[model samples]
Target: MSILLIILTIILPPLAVFLQHGLGKDFLINVLLTALGWLPGVIHAFYVNKR
Candidate 1:
């Protein structure tokens, strides 16, 4: 599950964040980061990974 989430994070950060933490702070942050920079969003999404 963690591996899958990580992969998803790499591919699509917002979706990965939404899957991990739902439509909360992390999700909002992921979207913001994605808008600011793609790599940052990927990193943030991976950081939010529960497992």
Candidate 2:
């Protein structure tokens, strides 16, 4: 993961995944998680970005 992704993940999880992987399952999951709660989205974004 890059610094920008790390920062974006904290501020906007879905956006971070969108930047890395675009509109797909990961992005969708992040969006849902973000809608539910900020922390879950952040964690999922980090996990997705790392892999």
Candidate 3:
């Protein structure tokens, strides 16, 4: 992943997911994960970005 993705994923996981995959299930999941906890969001963002 790029530096920007890493930074975004860390700072705003939902935003990072949205950037990579747009508005969809992954984005929604990321938003939910983010609401649940920062770490889960970050992990999900990274996982989504990696794919």
Candidate 4:
């Protein structure tokens, strides 16, 4: 599940964030980051590692 989230993050950051954390700050952040730059979005989306 986590691996899929990470992969989704790389492809579509906002969707990945939504899947992991639902519709909240992270989703907003992902959208902003995706607008700013694709790489940043990916990084932020995968920032939440289940550690």
Scored by TM-score, the top model is: 3
lDDT of 4 by residue, 1-51 (tens): 567776777888898778778898878988999999999988877775342
Every model's TM-score? 0.84, 0.93, 0.95, 0.82
lDDT of 2 by residue, 1-51 (tens): 678778888999999999999999999999999999999999999999988
Report the lDDT of model 1 for residue 12.
97
Over 1-51, each residue of candidate 1 has an lDDT whose tens digit, in order, gives 568877888999999888767899889988999999999998888778854
Pairs with steric clashes in candidate 1: none
lDDT of 4 at 14: 90
Candidate 4 similarity to native, TM-score: 0.82
In terms of TM-score, how similar is model 2 to the real structure?
0.93
1 or 4, greater by lDDT? 1
How does candidate 1 fare on TM-score?
0.84
In model 2, the worst 10-residue window by lDDT is: 1-10
Mark the regions of model 2 whose C-alpha exceeds 4 Å error after superposition. none
Candidate 3 lDDT by residue in tens digits, 1-51: 899889988999999988889999999998998999989989989999999
